[model samples]
Target: MTGPSIVVAGGGSAGHIEPALAFADAVRRLRPDARVTALGTERGLDTTLIPARGYPLELIPPVPLPRKPSGDLLRLPGRVRGAVARVREVLSGVDADAVVGFGGYVALPAYLGARGRVPVVVHEANARAGLANKVGARFAEAVAVAVAGSGLPGEQVVGMPLRRSITGLDRVALRAEARAFFRLPPRGPVLLVFGGSQGARTLNTAVAEALPGLVRAGVAVLHAHGRGGQAAPPAPGYVPLPYIERMDLAYAAADAVLGRCGMTTVAEVTAVGLPAVYVPLPHGNGEQALNAAPVVAAGGGVLVEDAELTGERALAELLPLLTDPRRLAAMGAAARASGHADADERLARLVLDIVYRHNLESARGAVGSDDRATEVLRPDPRVWRQQ
Candidate 1:
């Protein structure tokens, strides 16, 4: 295990990449000499993200597959084969001991790319399993999950890993610093809105339409409209930016939050103890909603059906909550209770254990027995690929 090299793979969005990077940092902490490299498709945010994090990144080709059976199904086998070949080629060049997938189309190739004896570990960040993670799970020595009930094999609830910067901040100090950083009135209640890494158009539109009403009611706003969301500034109390460079500031100053229910979003809000109004993406299965359910059930935040969230409707719900300071305080406390602060370390330990065990087993005569041996938790497969 000396100077062990690990490949952290999966990226298309910041959600997947951030967790991978966090785990890499944890690996460095555990073994300062450990070499970590990131593998992702050229198309994902990894191009800028991986490099910015100061990791060596290898570009792979795209692996696009429909969630459902489609004409794309015909290309799956060939695409997976090609991706596997490319992954193998990458592994050949690196001194890798294990490959870790963070759940995405890119993870499929990452797991498939491994040659004999190298263990593969995966992290699934939702209650419902993702397709790439599902396939990769079959090859995994262990699969770490953010939620308890995922259908993947060998799954353990590790909580969603967050960056050290986020994990280390003190909430009270952060809030004061955040308000100052955003130039908001120190005494006013702040409402934060975002639509994940790539803004949600529907969410953006509704929030924009509701902005004036929010401002009139005396609420201060720090909104991350995303590149896809509205770019125009709404009014005086509201600040609309293409993106928020310092998420710590955005999270710190917020009394209430409005955003999508992606796993990373849910984790960060919970970690920061920010009350939220989660609008799940409507199209794919109910994965986003599922991701937010435990928090809503715990009274940490309210869940709004995307289709039913009209501008008037959102205003009616949000205004009352924002106007009530006591209620916001209660919700904020509940949100903080949902965070597992040591998630990154827990997941990193799980991965390292799996890698060590798999390697040890291979050194013994236990070869093929470890390949398909996974801790299977029965999840409804019908729901795994939906969202």
Candidate 2:
């Protein structure tokens, strides 16, 4: 009488939540009858994002895996045991037919709870697999990755699951409207800047330092300085926001991007075909730089280390590219070429395949016609260029 019950577990940061949301979006689009509930924790950004997107969010206590051994580490076993029990409750309540994870704090419990209970599908967005995903992949029915070599079993290279807005963007067609939305000139080059969801002080400082030079060159700037993190001085053709809700429009308005190399950011920027200057965070296990490597290798972007991305350095590097139309267009094309716009559909189909036992022919009939089948997973090759 009802479609399969699906639970997606990816909580904590935007990097984890956004991809999970995108995959949930795809699942709904492909199978409207299915019930998709996002498994999250109260402490995560999911509390805001999941509800806003109209998905049911089930919250649980966060079980943080402490890196260094300490009191928290001592309590790890009991904490994990309690968290896994809570996850089992959530999964049972939802009658989850399958567990799809994007790898975050909640994923560990989800993986443990769903063990031998329901089919598990793990999608890792980073070049390097995380501890949670590394565990989940042990028994995951299907393991997918944006970039290969994540060391997850049966890891197939299926790009990041991006929202339809980005996957379906027509930047050139909406450039004027997008620029107008930000109260900027419709014809000049615009550069979009942002760090991760929380904003980056390093980027804010660098972009602030480069603002005067950018303004003088008639370059418009739209900076999402992250919530509660802004120090950029006011200048002509410059706009700063606490956060960016309409990244689709932001991509349309910008000729190029200057931002962090988080997997979600890289996926969205490239999915929309925007040339970028990716500054990988200097911390962590060096996965951020790995996220940006392929694009840089394909000549679609420039990768800079966080320590080296000064305002003076930003101005010197970005100035020439913003001014050069042909080169920028070329870079955008290359970025698009390396990106997988159909990842959402492909992942959705994969989910259907395992959960519902959907075969190729039945899947096509359920998703599209014979004609549409040939091209359902192929992104339109048209590159969006700045007006």
> Which one is best on lDDT?
2
Clashes of each: 2, 0
Show the lowest summed lDDT stretch of 10 residues, model 2.
378-387
Q: Ten-residue segment with the worst summed lDDT in candidate 1?
A: 377-386
The C-alpha RMSD of each candidate to the native structure, in angstroms, is 7.5, 7.0
Instruction: Name the best candidate (by TM-score).
Output: 2
Report the CA-based lDDT of candidate 2 relative to the real structure: 0.86
Candidate 1 structure, TM-score to reference: 0.86
User: In model 2, how large is the Cα lDDT of residue 77?
Assistant: 80
Q: What is the lDDT of residue 258 in candidate 2?
A: 96
How would you encode candidate 2's per-residue C-alpha lDDT over 113-134 as one tens digit per residue?
8998888999999999988999
Residue 324's lDDT within candidate 1 is 94
Over all chains combined, what TM-score does candidate 2 have? Answer: 0.88
Off by over 4 Å in 1: 68-72, 231-234, 359-387
